[model samples]
Target: MISVEEALRIILEESKALEGEEKNILSCLNKVLAEDIYSRDNLPPFDKSAMDGYAIKSEDTDLYKDGVSIELEIVDLIKAGESSDKELKNGQAMKIMTGAPVPEGANAVIQIEKVEVREDTLHISEKVKNGCNVIKLGEEIKVGDIALRKGTLIRPTEIGVLASLGYSKIKVPRNPVVSILTTGDELVEINETPKFGQIRNSNEYSLKALIQNLGLEALSFGIVEDKKDTLKSKVKEALEKSDIVITSGGASVGDFDFVEQVLNEINADIKFQSVAIKPGKPISFAVIDKKLFFSLPGNPLSAITTFEEFVKPACEKMLGKNMESDNTFPVILAEDFKEKEGRSKYIYVKIKAENGKLYAYKAGSQSSNQLITMSKANGIIIMPEGIGYKKAGEVLSGKFIFK
Candidate 1:
């Protein structure tokens, strides 16, 4: 049995950076950037008006001091999307609407409501500062400036930014194709009635949903019998088509656990097995022909926890996403915690802020098969080996799974 850290190191050593591909900007949302995206041109591109008002010179009116209103001739009326061909002269102003290009020689803008227009001449009623209500050229973003850095994931706001910058395509990492498999003779479909001691298989559904939530493609290979031949055939089929393969159940140390035997039968290059963790000690993982395989525990909670701690990160790395832990916040124990020594343990707990301090309360039960306990829990409190029990108010590091 390898330590969790050593197993992780071995797993990470097998991973390589995913390749990049050009994708349509619309399809690039939520995709990781492969290269830095630089602005093709200055934002706004030209000096434009920011308000639906007239453009005038800053010194056109003596309104800066006692607010002297000046009468100026409105030579042109420029609305949004229109440009003024005529340049403003001393004591002259252009009636420019919002988003319209500011006329040359105009240093300020006075709102139309602030002026009383009589035929061609306009009377300003308030002081106008230089460059007021105007969006200068390259004000928001300059040309050649990097709008987004490499490895950055594009979101809706990023799409908007790229659209505003006139980008129709973006370079993003190639999303890996993943296949999920489950092996058990005592498992049946949810819609079918279990015979004798068989139970409905929940691993496939939960694992599929978890994979999809990570923004990747996941395919189910259906359930295979726990027999070595059936398991081996299923593994080969999934490995032939996918970059990563995940299997749940048949990973424990029982005599019927054929996952390890199946891998060895196919001459799979075993990477690591049996991580030093509670509720998930029987996890198995291997790398065969550059493809990844993960054999999760049969217990639902154990499967989910192992997926979050290991499989999720592996998938993210394969997708070129910079994944980080969200549950690094300091949390105090709500009550005393006890456990056996040796293996590291992860206990589900409900975390909330109480009296301006964060506290964690243990969930109902610690049974590996209890999915309801995990559903009611908010986070996992990590208890490393040799540190068995913790008293109330003891500070410990934890992670929020649903956050």
Candidate 2:
């Protein structure tokens, strides 16, 4: 067994980002940029009016001081998407609508509401400063400037930016296809009644939902029997069809556990067979033919725990997302808990906020098979290795779940 950090490092070091593909900008939302995006044309393209206003030289209104009004001749009216050829001289103004290009030699625009116009003469009581109410050419983004760097996440705001930059199609990393397979002879489908000493398979459902939460679809190969040859064939097929394969069950050491044997037989590079983490120690990670394979424990809580805390990061990295930052925060324990000293313990609990401090309370029994314990939890408190038994009022690092 290895430390959780070492196991994670091995997984990430073995994972590789997918190749880039040309996707339509609209469909590229939530995707990672493959190249630096430089502006092909200046935003706005020219000096335009920020609002409905009159464009005039700033010095033209210098004489209007002490609540005095100044009058200027109106040269022409420029509406949106229109331009004025008239040169704005001192004592002359052009009525420009929002988004209308300002005429040459104009340095200021006074809002229409702040000025009165009568008989083609514009009157302004307040002195308009230079560059007032005017959006200069390339104010948002200049030509040749990088608008977005490579590896940036594309959001709705990025969609608008790309559209403005005339990027109808963009290059983004290809999303990896994930496959799910559940194993065990004692497991039955949710719709079927389990025989004596059998239970319904819930790990497949949990894994599928987890994959969907990451905006990726998973193909389920249904349930495979515990036989070594059958499990081996299904694992091979999953590897052939998908970039990532996740199998929940037949991972732990037991009379019927055959995940390791099958992996060795297939010549797969098994990175780690176990990690020093409670409820998920039997999880295994392997790389075969440039594809990732994860054998998660059969227990429902253990399977979910391993997937969320370990497999999710590998998937995210392949999709060109950063996952280096730790989400743990100091949380006070509201109840006492005890465990063995060999592995790091992750206890699911209800976190409550009182007086701006977070406190972790027991949700239920922390059993590997008890999915109810995980269901009732909003967060998890992590107890580090070496030390055991934490009493109420003790503090541990914790983070919200499924956040």
Give the winner by lDDT.
Answer: 2
CA lDDT, every model vs. true structure: 0.85, 0.91
lDDT of 2 by residue, 1-403 (tens): 8998899999999877899999899888887898899999999799999989899999988888876799999989999988887788888999999999989999988888998989999989977899998999999989999999988899999999999999999888888899999999998899999999999988889999999888889999988998998999999999989999999998988989999999999999999999999989999999999999999999988999999888888888888877778889999998888878879989899999999999999999988998999999999999898878999999999999886
TM-score of each: 0.89, 0.93
Best by TM-score: 2
Question: How much does candidate 2 score in TM-score?
Answer: 0.93
Model 1, 179-285: lDDT tens digits are 98887889999899999989899988888888888877798998888788888888899999988899999897788889988889888889888999887888988
**Candidate 2, overall lDDT?**
0.91
